[model samples]
Structure formats: structure tokens, C-alpha cells
Target: MKEINREVEAILRDMIEQRVRAMISGEATSNDLLGILLETNIRESQEGGIKNAMTTEDVIDECKLFYIAGHETTTVSLTWALILLSMHPEWQERAREEVLNLFGASKPDYDGLSQLKIVTMIMHEVMRLYPPVNFTERSAAAEVKLGEVTYPPGVHFLLPHIFLHRNPETWGPNANEFNPERFAQGVAKASVHGAFLPFSGGPRVCIGQNFAMLEAKLCLARILQHFRFELSPAYAHAPYTLVTMQPQFGAQIIIRRC
Candidate 1:
């Protein structure tokens, strides 16, 4: 296990080094996040000033963060949304109907995607029920007080996304059920007390929230445009968590061309 960990770490380091060097030396041109970050670092270093840009190490750290926080979480959320949609054909049909009405068997434009009301509702509900990360942690810098509970200084707090999202008190009676209608009004008004925290909330919210949303929307749109999916007979209804919550068995969904 230790050897495997060291091997993985070395591979990550090598990849980061090669990527950064490519951007710095003008050997690779990509429009992806890594390329943009590398470009920024290179430009800033040339312009001169520590305050102007992140260091190489800082850029590498951002790359690592992007891998851990951006890629897996985004993919997991998308997978969960698809699985949920497959299980609930009513929602799937409605989403597909919405997709067809706007895009109509053609490529979905960004403008049209932004107007997908039903799709947005379905996405939000899925996020609420199956947030990519099950839990997150934060340590108090100082004593904090909110309502009846007071947390002492340096106290580590665990915020369980699954519990908060599914609790009856937080989201009312149907919290455990899959109902996208709850978010029909909008996210800000979905939970009056602000219990919804899929990508988390506040200043330290997920950095790639917008990116993930856009990607998921586009992916869902494309899939619905030509395919209707449902759970296959072989599919087991077991969900478990590793780093991110995923199907304990693989998601075995049947796809039919629309």
C-alpha cells in the first residue's frame, strides 16, 4: 500500500511537472483549466511581482486541488443525476421534453441550456439527495455561537451533507423523497433556512460550481436529445460511498435511442 501510494504520488508529480513545463515553454496549447492556469503563471512571472501571480508550487497545488475537488465530484454528481433520472421516468420524460422543446434534435446552445427550467429543477433535487461528497469538515478559529449551540475555539465540526439534506426538519416532510418541484421557484428559495449545500455554501463554496453545473447541464442535454435511459434488469439498487458516493455495483442503465 505504501509503495502504491508513493508510485501514485510520483506519477502525479511527473504529470504536474510536464504540464507546467509545457505551458511555460510554449510546447502545449490547451483551453482547459490547467492550460489557463499555467498561462497565467507564465505571464505573471514575466511581468514581475510575487503578488502578481501564483508561484509554480502554488500552481501545482491548484492542479492537485482541481483533480481532487473538480473532476471526481463533477463526474460523480453527473452519474448520480443520470441514475436518479433513469429510476424516475416521469422526471426523465419531462426533462427530455424540455430539452427537445428548446434544442429540438440539434446542438444545444448555451443560451437555450440556461433556459431549461425543468432540467434545472431535476438537477437540484438530485444534488440535494446525492451530493458527491457525503460530508465535509471545518475547524473553528475562535468560539462561535449560533442559536442554541455554541462551538468552542479550535473545535472541528463535521457537516454531513446527506443528513442535512434529507432531514424532515430542514426540508419538510418530503425531504427523503425525490421531488424536484421543491426547487421550482429557484435555489435561493428552495430551502427557506438555506439547508441545501450540494456544492456547499458561503465564501468557501466549491470553486468549480459554475463549471460543474454547465458541464452537467450540457451532458444531460446531449444525452436526452437522443437517448432515453432506464435501469436495466441486472442493476442492483445499492449506493455506497468511497471518496464520493457512487453505485456499490456499477450503474446498469439501459439506453434507447430517442
Candidate 2:
């Protein structure tokens, strides 16, 4: 792990150096996240001196975080969405019909995507069944008490959202089943409050939650516009967690152009 991290840092460092040189030479202006971060750091240094600006190491750390946290989570979520949709052709047809009605074969737009009620429900249902981050952790800042138990400061708690999302008490007997209709009224009314957190709740919830949903919606919509798909006989049903929940044997599906 350390060796891999070192390699990644080396590549990021090289990229950052090139961008910094370009900015310094006035060769180009960047508006992307990296460029914006570097520009902000430069502005800070100019205004408050180097002492107040993010160091090169700090910038590298931010870049590494964006690369890891922003990439795999969404990729796996899309994978699961495709797998589930293929397994349920009725839902797949419903989603595809909605997509066709909204935008036909043209590229999906922000307004059209937002108006995708069926697609939105499908994505929400997918996340509920196969949440990318199955669990999240938190540490007690001070002593705390539950209904009957008390915990001391510094204690850690691992909250498994997958079980919560599937609990019969909150989601009824069909909790384990895939049903996008549950989300027809939206996530808040999908089940009991706090029971449907594909993105963990509270102030520190995943920052990429909205971005991830938007990205999945757009991609899924576009795919539906161009193809019809079904699960392959070679596909397996194993879901395991590495960094996030993923199909153990990979998602294999047969696709035909529309």
C-alpha cells in the first residue's frame, strides 16, 4: 500500500509541477479543480504570505483524495444499477421508456435528467440494495448514552447502512426485494426517517452524494437511449466489499443496440 501511494504521489507531484509552471509563465489559465486549487493557493500566498497558503504537500493530499473518493464509488454504483436493471426487464423497460419519452436518442440535458422520475426511483432503489459504501464509521467526541448503553469518549462505531436499508422493521417484509415504487414519492417518504441512507447522514455525509447521483442518472439515461440489455448466463451473484461493495465476479450482461 505504501509503495502504491508513493507511486501515485509521484505522478500527482509531476502533474502539479507542470501546471504550476504553466500558471507562472502565463502560458494558460486553468479552471478545473486542480487549477482552481493551485490558483487559490497562489492568491492566498500573495495576500497573506506563504504562511497562510496551502503547502504543495497539502495540495497533493487534496488531489489524491479527489482521485480516490470521487472515482470508484460512482463506478461501482453504476455497475450495480446496470446489473439490477438487467435482472428486472420490466423495470428496465420502464426506465428505457421514460428515457425515450424525455430525450429520445439525443444527449440527456440537466432539465430532462432531473425530470426523470422513473429513472431517479430506479437509481435510488439500486443504491438501497447495493450501496457503494456499505458502512461508515464515527468516533465519540464525548461520553454518550443510547437507550440502555453508554459509551466512553474515543470509542468507535461502525454503522452498516446496508442492514439498516434492508431491515424489515423499517422497510416491511419486502425489504430485501428490489422495488423502485417505494421511492416514487421520493427518498424522504421511501421509509422511516434515517432508514434509507445510501449516503450516510448528518453534517459529514458524503460531499459527492448529489454529484454521484447526477452522474449516474445521466450515464444510465444515455445508455438506455442506445441499448437494451440483460444479464448473461455467465454472470455471478456475489457482492463483496473491497473498498466498496462490488460484484465479486464482475457484471456480465448482453447488450443490443436500440
Query: How high is each candidate's TM-score?
Result: 0.87, 0.95
Highest TM-score among the candidates is held by which one?
2
| lDDT of residue 33 for candidate 2 | 94
Among residues 3 or more apart in sequence or in different chains, the pairs in candidate 2 whose N, CA or C atoms overlap within 3 Å are none
lDDT of 1 by residue, 93-200 (tens): 999999999999899988998999998898899889998888888999999986999999999988998898898987888888999999999998887677888888
Question: lDDT winner among the candidates?
Answer: 2
- What stretches of model 1 exceed 4 Å from their correct place? 1-5, 19-29, 45-57, 142-154
lDDT of 2 by residue, 135-219 (tens): 9888999999978999999999998989998998898999999999999999988868678887787897889888988999999
Model 2 segments more than 4 A misplaced: 146-148
- Model 2 poorest 10 in a row by lDDT: 191-200
lDDT of 2 at 237: 100
